[model samples]
Each structure stands twice: as C-alpha cells, then as structure tokens.
Target: MSFKYMPVLRSRENEKRAFKNFFDNKIFSSNTIIPLIEIIQYSPNRKNTTDSKLPEEIFEESYVNEFKNYDFPIIVDIPMYIDLNSNIKQKYKDFLSEMLSNSNKKTPSKRLIYFNKLSKLKNIIPVVSYNPNAPYPLKTISTQEKYLRTNFNKIAFRVFVNINTITHILNEVEQSITSEDILILDLQDDDYKETKFNTLFQKIEDIKTSKKCKTIILNTPITEDIIKKNKNVQNDCPINAIDNSIVFSYKSFGFDAFGDYAGIKKYLGPDNNGNNYNPPVTYNIFYAYHQNKYIKFKSQTINASKPVVAPSITKSKCWNMYGHTHHKNCPGCIEINNKSIDTSKPGNWGTWQAINIQHYIYTMNDFL
Candidate 1:
C-alpha cells in the first residue's frame, strides 16, 4: 500500500524464508517495502509424477495461511506464463477479501485512524495480466476485468510493453482499467535507451494526465546475461555494480515506485508440462548485496580441472576484502559471517537465496 519499492518474489521456499526472516529480524520497515508475490508456475519433472502440483493447490497449501503473518500489504500475481484459470482467479480474490475483513475486525481503537488511512490503499492488491498477443486475448481481459469488479477495492494490472507498443496496448485495454488501478510496466530484460526512456516517460505522464491510471510502476530486470558477462571479464569473484539510474530517472514523472526481480533473473524455465531434466554437477555460488551492487562469489565450476574448497561466501576473497565493510550487518550477513551454515545442501540453496534477498530488501528500502 503506497510502497516505495516492490521486489518481485516468486512463491518459493527461499523467498518465503527471506521475507519471514527479514520481518522477524526487523531489518526494514514494512511501510516502505511491499513485496509483489508471484505464484510460480508449476514445472513437473518427468521422472517424478508426484512432484506436480496445480497453481491453485500451491496457493492453498503454501500461501493462504502465510498471509496472516505479514503485516505489510502484498500484491499477489499469477505469472504471465501460467494459464489464467478462472477457478484460481476467483480463489485468490476470495482469499484477499477474507484477509481484508479479518484485518478490519482486528484493528484496535488506538490504531483505527492509521488502519483507515492504510485501508484506503487496500491491504491486498490483485494483479491482472493484459497481453494482446496472448491466446484468447479478449476472454483473458474479460475474465480479469470481471474478477477485479467482483470484490477488490483497488487492482494492479501488469503488461509487458515497450515504447513501441505502449500506446496500442493502453488503447486496447483502456476500458478495462480505471483511475484507481495501478499500472505496472514490466520491461523484462530490456536494455535502457535514453530516447526510448524519454518517450516511455512521456507516455506514462500522458496516461496519468488522461486519468487512464493514477499509479504507475516501472519494473525491469538485471538479466543473467549482464551478470554472466561481468563474471567472464573478472574471471575470479566479480563484484557487479548495477545502479538504479533508470528507476531514479522516472522520479521527475511522479511515478509511484520502482520494481525489480529482486536480485534473481526472471524465470524463463520449462513450462507446466513435465520435462526430462537431470541434475548437473555444479558448485554453489554465493551472493552478497551492498550499495546497489551484487558481489558474486564463484566457486569451482563442474568442469574445472582443479577444485576449490570454498563452501560459503565468507571464504571468498571478496567477502574478506569488502563484504564485511560493504554489506549490511543484517541476519543474512551475520549468518554468512559466522561460518555456521552450509551453502551446498539442496535445502540450503534456499539459505543462500534468502541471504541475497534479505540484503536486497534492506538495501532497496534504504535506497528508495
């Protein structure tokens, strides 16, 4: 609700662990950070039939109960890759309505004013996807519009559009959107160009001026290609410094906030259908976030002739040289610094991810 930073997090154990740990440690204020929780699409392994679970099932088992633990407002979205099932859509809306009603009942007299003020912003915001190129576009838009009109006080509609297609997409969906709804412009892995950005900013301003949408968010990704390219140049442990130049550039336009895929790349993996994927021999790569940059601690590669025995981020030269000074002394950094956790175990991959996400959220809150 009126957040400065929206970190797009997938509905995975790692992200959940990070959010809970961040909240428990009081690392950042809830007021400034509103996590956009994307329900990850289910990808089944061909060898394991039981591994497959429907998106709706995942929501009920993993997220429905977890919503009570978070005090801050969260934006729930179904990833664009997933087929928008009507059953799941209605279920999510029902869950949000129930949560809002429960929150209203729990508000104390002393906090009533504050509660009312925040309630106006809506405690649970649902995201509707609008992509004209998608299959059955009219049906998709109509279903989402009906869902939004049913119970949600305010909604956020997500669309992947660049300067070239922004006008067309806006015109197509203008009737479905409202002034109160939030417009999320997802620039997935698009490199920033000054002329394009200038035009895009003007388009956003035009949307607001025309009352097409009042709140707009600019979302982009730090692609895997960027990280890999930087790593190849450095060879050793590379410190990748990415600035928020694009995010800050939109400040003058009165955009609501900036969003990103946290520190992880956007998921473009296998579809919902099962695949014959096999596990590969690879070492864990530790990550640390500090000062708007990600420091990657690369261990021995699978094909390396000689193996390095560094098991955690603390063992890396970068950690010893600058991590202690550059990183925040939060729970994640403390866990890595203490040298107690193993970063190699399958479950512990989540720990490593949690570490970076924890730091990313902390850094973004301060930066924003």
Candidate 2:
C-alpha cells in the first residue's frame, strides 16, 4: 500500500535470477508479436514528500545507472512519464517514424512514448496479453481462436472471471461459439451475489450446451460463502477458497489464474485434508509489482518511456494479453502492503522496459 526505499543485491545477479524465473514458468503467449507495455509515474523534481531536502537528482541518477545495461528497443510510455511542456514531441513530431526514430541526434525520438486507445497515432502499435476469463473484444478473441486451433489440439484453457471483466468473457465465448477448442471457465472471487452467480452459471450452461467442451472453476477469494451454494451445479467444480484480504495471496493468483505470479499453485489450494499448501513455482515475477518502483526511481533523468504493448509475452503465438494498471508511459509496477524491498526503500516502484524481452526471447527460443 505504501512505498519505501530498499537495497539492490548484486544487481546483475538479481536481474538474472528474475529473468530465469519469468521464462521457466508456463505463461500463455498468443501468436502475435504484441509487446507488453508496463508503465509507472516517475517524478524526480518532487523531493521525498517525507524529506524535501533530499536532492531528487541523485536518486534518479542511481536508478538509471542500475538499469542502463539493459539495452533494447524500449517503447517508453511518453505521455505520463515526461514533462508536458517539453519539446521532444514538437521537435520530432513530423511523422510517426520520427516519433520512434533514434538515428537523428538533433531530433532523436525519445523512447518515452504515449498514446490513448483512440488516439490517431500510426505505427504506434497496441498490445495486450490474453485474458480468457473476461469478455474480450470480438476481433481480438477471433484472432486468438484462429491461432489456438492452428497450433495445438485439445488445449487446456482457463479463465478467471469477475464482474468487470465478464463482458470480455462473453465476447470470447461469442467469438468461439463456432470454434473447435474447448473452454474451461474459472470464475474467481467471492464478492458476487447469488442472483449474479446463477445468471453467470446459466450463461455458461448455454455456451457449453452449444459450444465445444467447457468446465467451470469456482473459487471464493475471501469467505467461501458462495462456493457452498453453487458447488453442486452440474457444470461447476470447486477448486479452492482464499482470503482476498491477504494482499500477497490476492496479487499472487486471485486476480486472474495464471495472470499473477502464483496462479496455478494458489488456485489448487490444500488437499481434502486441510494442511499447509506449498505449491511449486511454475513461474516467478521477474519483476514484482513493487519492484517497478525501484526500476522507475533508479531510471535515468531522460524522458520516461511511453507505455506500449508487452512485446516480450505477446508474440505471433499470443492472442490477447491482460494485466493490472496502465498509463501512457507506465513503468509497469506498483506497491501493495508495506513490505520493504531490498533495492531502494521498500516503497519505491520499478518501471520496466526490455526486461520482458529477457523472458520473451527465452520463451520463443526455448519453449516455442
């Protein structure tokens, strides 16, 4: 919830470990080369609200120095990260290529990028990681369905649904109604009321009856109040119950199955006999949510990177991508709870650029 400064262990070693963990795990990637755009708000001039005297320059300098080694085509989320008054936009605003072009020194295209969904900026690609549970844009889901059927047969699909994202799920089902792939809908969280739950179940029942194979995964993230009533539905399968109040567990997997760090592991929960659950690490956060705070603070004084699609995870094989939080030039990270990180204070966030590439490249070479 709050932020703090922490330490960075041997920087290279820690980053290497993070990269290894990210790629080793099983994360879904659609077949398109959609880049993951992670963004964070970077404010260097504003000294620590806690300590105004601390020169912000030193902190930012250190931040950039730490990550400068990661040289790659970084798509900076420009709008949110840079000074609006700055002329980087005007000086190089002649064309789209100029916006991204880095060759001309006088008007070097700063990697800091920015755009709104409807903004008419060409060559500024939009990217998303797939979210199977939520309703999705028809076009996106249609594209995903085509890719899935082409590559693999009998794919084990999972979806983590909630009220907000349910629309996307409906869109996906509508798109997939004629497709050959089976869909396993994992309806997560406990906040929904009975009427809504039944309504959702009915919708699924209809889809299943008409569509290909389908299964329902139900979990109550706080109290298992709803699970008790709905466990017996013909299509519903109770997997696990969790306390949504626990920030770590909620972030780990509760948000969306496979969307968070410990998705499959937490969703499985304990065996029939209640006991300590120790799930294996199928994937780890190469960069944790709060880790981005440090990444941003440690980044250079240069303009912030504009947010773009996550290039690492979204590839030719990926259909759609999803994650929490967004900004024009977001440094894809956040702080939840008061845990102290080791790099800056426990409070700083680490924004990323090219780190996703570390895992993405590895995934393409090793897995695909």
Candidate 3:
C-alpha cells in the first residue's frame, strides 16, 4: 500500500487510542498514512520500586499489534537510548520471530498477517538508527544491515543529523542502503531557518543524485517551547499556526513523504523516575492541524476544586467561531463541541492527545 504521510508516533496508550479510533471508524484509508511507531523506553512503576523494563519487554507490550487489522505498513522503531547490546539484541530478534510466528496462526496465510500468530508478517517495518553519536555506531549499522538482509523486505534506516553531519552520515550509509529501503531524515524540534532548509534541500538533492534510496521521509516535531511561546502572545486564545512550508518545499525535490511527531514533543533524553503525579491545577491545551499548520488552543487554568467544569476554550466565542470554520468534525471536534466531555482533569490529558492526533491525521490525509 502507498502512504502519503509518515506520522512519528510513540508506542503508548494515547497513540494507540488515536490509531484505533481513526482506523475503526473508517475515517480514512489506512494506506494513506504510515505510522512510524517509536518503542519508547518503559518508565518506572508508580511506586518507583522496580527498574524499568528492558527493550525486549517493552517490545512485547508495544501497541503495534493494535493496528493488526489495518492494511498499511507500520514502521516499528527502537529509540536511540536503548543500547543494542548482545543480550538485548538477541531478545529483540526473538521477539520479532515470535510476533511473526504468532501472527501466522490466527489468520489464513493469504490474508495479511494482522498479528496472525502463526506466520511471518510482511508489513511491519523495522527501524535502524545510523546516528554516529549513538553507542557502537558500527554495531548499529551492522544491525540495521542485518535487518535489511534478513527478515524484513524493507528497512527504514534513520539518521538524526543537522547540516554539519548530513553529508557524512549520508556517505557513511550509502554503501549499506539500497534503493528499496526508506531513509528517514529526522530534524527533531529544530526551529525553522532558511539557511538550514536550503542546506538540507541540497543534501537531499545529493542523495537523489546518488540514488541512495527511493523513499526518503522528513520528520520534525512541534516542540512545547513553540506552543508556550504562542500561548504567551497577547491575543486571547490565539490560534498558533505552525509553518509547514519546509515540508511541502521538499516535495518538489522528489521526497517521498513528510512526517512530524504528531503534535507530540520529541524526547531524546533518558527515562525519568516513574512519578505520575497530577498537578492540582492545569490548563487544557488542545491541538488541531489545518492548512499545513498545527493549531494549539489553550484554556485558562482549571483548578482541582472544580474538576468537572469544561475548559474556558470550549466556552469562549473564539472556539465557537473556529469550530464552525476550521473543525473537521473528527472525534476530537465532537468531544470539544460536547461541553459535557470535560478534559479539564489532568488524568484526561490522554483523551485530549488522542483527539489532537486523530484530527491531525484526518486533516493530513485530506491535504496529502
């Protein structure tokens, strides 16, 4: 199946919610978008007693299987922080084998293995990072190469680099990659700059000139800093629009697709101690995507004393006007329109995240 957008989503509950809701409702064709699911490291439990789960355990519990019923390819990726040591490496391989074997069992061989549990699943694309700064760069490259040569028909080899290292990384991996594979150029949370975009455009031209890979995806994130800065503006509940011209600009250069963190921030740091504490007071920040710009809607702070109240954004005239003008009638929009669906409580943040992501995917499909 062909894909137009590559949304870099984490393997977490909120993302799962978004995927399931989007696909189950038949909102759009699954083939329209390919989700790059990053298997985030497990955090400590609420009690904070035990250590976090190893890479293998996290893989086993990943939400990848939730999309088993979908027709499109799903790219599963391990974050860079998880070192590819021998033990964890073997576990990852075994986990993949088990998932493939298990998938074949539940469904007929002719049908695409949606976690069939008995045969190999052809649509699960594995990601192999080629970052030089990562531990054991040679080993990482070798592991990625092994995946490319072995089980999977296609591999998404990713590199997170800036202008300084783009040429080096591209040259370094040129020999190992093939025309069939996907190359991910991850520009995580970098503020947009003309010079940087031009340099990247040239680098991509070089890759195309060399015929390094046929499918190259460019991914960036809408950072919290951007959201905060916009919210601080003088306008009341201002609609913060994120510029996406950089993504569209590359389309003319024959780039396969564009991607982002699905409105989620890109976290590259180590796992924090598992402390899931809800603040006594918080604002309801909602997100939407329209006309290639990510829209952020912030509400006044909601105190814990009145957890049941709807956020001010929902009650404001601005939201009402925007809803009528720009809303896509997605599940998120429906929820927002229904003032009874309170997203004020801190625990309900996932609901909002899922809403934003669902709408974002819906809008992106229309544009793509």
Candidate with the greatest TM-score versus the true structure: 3
Model 1 Cα lDDT, one tens digit per residue, 160-209: 65555566666655666777677777766665444566666676667766
CA RMSD of each candidate after superposition: 9.4, 20.0, 8.0
Please count the clashing residue pairs in each candidate, in the order shown.
0, 83, 12
In Å, residue 176's CA in model 3 sits off its true spot by 2.8
What candidate 3 gets wrong by more than 4 Å, as runs, is 42-58, 61-67, 81-119, 131-139, 196-199, 209-217, 228-231, 234-242, 267-273, 284-296, 300-329, 339-347
If both were scored by lDDT, which would come out higher, candidate 1 or candidate 2? 1
The whole-model lDDT of each prediction reads 0.54, 0.29, 0.54
TM-score of 1: 0.68
> CA shift at 170, candidate 1, in angstroms?
1.5
Q: Write the per-residue lDDT of candidate 3 for residues 135-238, one digit (tens) a residue.
A: 33334454445534566667677876566666666665676676667777776655545455666656665675586564555555455566566665442343
Q: In candidate 2, what are the lDDT values of residues 80-160, reduced to their tens digit? A: 112223343232122223233442233322221222221222222222123333234345434433443343333323344
Badly placed stretches (over 4 Å) of model 2 are 1-138, 156-168, 177-180, 218-368
* TM-score preference between candidates 1 and 2, better one: 1
